[model samples]
Target chain A: MPRTVILGVIGSDAHVVGITILEQALEAAGFDVVNLGVQTSQPEFVAGAQDHGADAVLVSSLYGHAEQDTRGFHHRLTQAGLGDVTTYIGGNLAVGQDDFAETRETFREMGFDRVFDAETEPEEAIAALQQDLEIPLTETDAEEPARATL
Target chain B: MTRDKRLPESELQRIASDLRDDWPTAEAVEFTEAVEYHGTLPAEKRFAEVLETADRPLLQPRAGVPRLRDQIELLEGLRTEGGADLLPTTIDSYTRDNEYAKAQEGLEEARETGEDTLNGFPAVNHGVDGCRELIESVGAPVEVRHGTPDARLLAMITFAGGFQSFEGGPISYNIPYTKRRDLAQTIEQWQFVDRLAGLYTEFGVTINREPFGPLTGTLVPPCIAIAVMVVEGLLSATQGVKSLTLGYGQVGTLVQDVAALRALQSLGDEYLPDDVTVTTVFHEWMGGFPPDEARANGVIGLGGATAAIAKPDKVITKSPQEFRGVPTMEANAAGLRTTRQLIDMLLEQDVQIDGIDAEQEFIERSTRALLDTILERGEGDVARGTIRAFETGEFDVPFAPSESAAGQVLPARDDDGRVRILEFGDLALPDEIREIHRTKLDTRAETEGREPSFKMVADDVDAISEGRLIGRPDGSNPAPSGGDD
Candidate 1:
């Protein structure tokens, strides 16, 4: 089975750092991670996932504009032949001044598979990817052999 | 407790006394002349003396009585020398403008004679093209000026202060004999004559000239200073250039009261070019050492009430503590929130505004957070720990001896186990206790909307060892009633 990817920045209203961090983290996670960095337009994200044949497209935005920026992004992905790809997003996705629950619901309606708040740990992200991939959590052998493929 | 007001005269005397006490051997000159520009004997005599002492060889010839013609000659000579350097450097590399035109000219000549192909891989160009395409794709607001003359003349009026400050400091300081006249001429010729006027002809960037004042002394009048700043800003915007920014020190003292704000507003209204925006700097102390009642009155007593009356596009205000250097996290958080509030308020007033977040304050807070983590946990425990060693205890010292001594002692550990003392002064507490205090603050900030201050996540094992409660569940807890037996 293909490995699942989970990614996003963990902060508020500063997207530039988030984008760069996500790109580096996802590549190191042993999965084909299509990272849609900060202030990314919805269509470009969908295109990136489709082009890379990615199993998942992870979105990270730190700016409070994520609510506006990420609105309808999932639907756009599906329309762009990336419906099979799972979508993940996190960070201070909404302005801190308002109710985050309502904002989360709004994003859910727009088709996000999972939503994490600003404080979600990286380990939690890794666990989520394992669960999403249906990998056995009990596979605790001392070591696993690396698969070689051309 | 409220602090007593320090009178301006007393404050000046105190500063002078302090300087005298610090530098007993050095000769200190005291002048009581009013801060003004041009024509008066005090200013004229000072300007002549400055020119005569200039370090540049060419400027020595025309070092007295800066008439327009004399000013023109001095400027022309500098321009010719500087241009020789500028043209050559531009041809050699795309890095940035050369400080000296002669060096620039040599590089340009070398590039012309050198055999190097400009062609490169198209893919790299494609990537650049892609980035540019992305940037352009993001639609931005278009700014429309009334006309080119309005823009250009307006530029002159704006930048007059920056020009004056850039020119004034060197002369006032009496830097060196050979350089002073040349520097003054360079300021006049390059910034004023060629760049401002020539840009109008070459780029059709119009600039307006209002009646500027005569130089009375070292200090540029507030009105002219502000106008010159505006012109510099306009030129920068038009030329797509950025200048080394200058700080407005003690601007609070200059425009403290409602009367000062009103006067500034009236001057801006009367002289500011139409279609240009104006702003003012106001200093207020929210947290830190309490300002004297008079200085405090000069600040918060106005409560932006005067700002409301002035109705400038923006008003930048900072606490006294921020100016002094060591700003607390709470102060910074408050300041950031206040900036957001101010921006909102200005927007409500239908004004376009941008607030400058004190970079030093932000860096200090962020550094403190990192420092707290390092002092508690040691290196490799947190990401921000790397920058912790850079923080010097001497930074908090107001006087030279204390600062120098702190610098010497702090970088090296004491013969005893303890690190050299922290520079928090009265605020200093036990390092161990401060870490706990900072941890609580960091925890609150993390749980709240703010980002976690530390670069690395707190160690859960260590936290548990330390009796800090974490929410991880163990399977030994009682099963639910509906669980299978």
Candidate 2:
């Protein structure tokens, strides 16, 4: 079975392009992707994972409010029994160019398994998802896949 | 919401009253007194007249802050330092989502800490008095620019507060700006906004209603953007709005952007009632910007050059700091001046590009296809047709996050760097039009030595930001100087 992954832009940040591209990338890499779009809350993320039996949840934010928006996100996921599902956070995680190393460290401490910067392309995330999920990196299997739903 | 029918007078009043209660500051809205106050403002402060009478493409910058004093100071700097022809008071996101209490908290925090807590001015939190203060302070005409799906309360307050022009419509604001808002609900809500603006026009204030043109602000095909503009324009005219400025965003391709702008104005006039004077606004590249300031300025310069050739009525400027969230006021003014320098140098040169006519013809034909499908779906009612078309995927915006849209259609740049549809989804365009797009994209695929696929679409999305118009594969072309990492 194709591995399932849930993707979304967390909090009030309405930026969707990054996640939209990432969705296409991961789906092309053979993941059964469910994109939650933007302004997605932690509960919504948990519910989406629960509903889809997702293997991973990729959180994206571009408005510099990710740190505040994801304060209790991992705890909520753990409470919801999604602790075993992999979690990834990406995009402009902080307000300023205050070293992405620190930002990545901060989100890693918040319990994300992997973190990506704003400039990180979709391939990098796809590769990381494959590495974390142990999916074999063969030819891209996406054949003009249907638009993602839910 | 059922059909594209005008809201009755009684219904307009009922909703206006209810909207006033969304927040306490809304209590200060007095229609008759507000009309009188609008009469007191000078002609120079009128948005529609100033825009309509302009001899050249006027420059306007997007800017807003939490505090009223700081917002005023910011606008003052843009006006004096940037030489902005028009000014915008972009509303905060909480206000856009109608989260007034949160906006109030942000406003209070900004006031106390002297740091911007909100991304934009929470106009609703400021209420009528505060909006009036902003209008009175800005020397030039100010437009209330926000992406509110339900701008009913905002319209009631901002209009009564003396701002004459407002940006956004049901589809333009909802599809690109948010998720989960029903299209039918927003259409019904924006009807109230247009109806109110029409009422003001009848009272001798020509409020300029501009439909947000840059839906998704990505590689939106020209036909799709222009069709949405005409649909919104027709809807606004139905509500008695007389002065309309349809908008088009720069897509980076010189020929295509110019053609799209012209098509937007022509189609807007052809579709809407003649009594409604139609103008066009050109938004500088709304997609991702190069992280480097120098390269970002190049993007802005190309936008100005296109505006000069297209001769749009107003040009919305983008700051070089766009890649980094909200911009400082100085950077905002600097962007305006940069555009101003480019436009002044080229506006009088009469430079013309080849193939503009053919490109414009194609755009017009495609736009008509979408509009006709929409009208048919509504069964002759534009508003009803719009809602039904979106529901059925007959009309769609690419990269839309809103649940109301199918989001199935995808766009990519052709070999010539012009945006073309990569995925049709359920859009209503004719097979021949689809063939044209397919052929252009196929040409691009041949040049790139790859089959036309989603990979092209993805590459095209980040092309301009990487200092190139087309996303060629690595090793085929080296990254241009100042390309973003």
Best by DockQ: 2
True contacts kept of each: 0.00, 0.39
Q: Which stretches of candidate 1 lie over 4 Å from their true place?
A: A1-14, A136-150, B1-157, B160-485
Candidate 1 is graded, for docking, as incorrect
- Tell me the whole-model lDDT of each prediction, alpha carbons only: 0.31, 0.90
Alpha-carbon RMSD to native, per candidate: 24.4, 2.7
Q: How high is each candidate's TM-score? A: 0.31, 0.94
Model 2, residue B418: C-alpha shift (Å): 0.5
Interface RMSD of each: 18.3, 4.6
Worst 10 residues of 2 chain B by lDDT: B475-484
* Candidate 2 Cα deviation (angstroms), residue A121: 2.8
* Cand. 2 Cα-lDDT: 0.90
Best candidate (score: TM-score): 2
Give the lDDT of residue B164 in candidate 2: 98
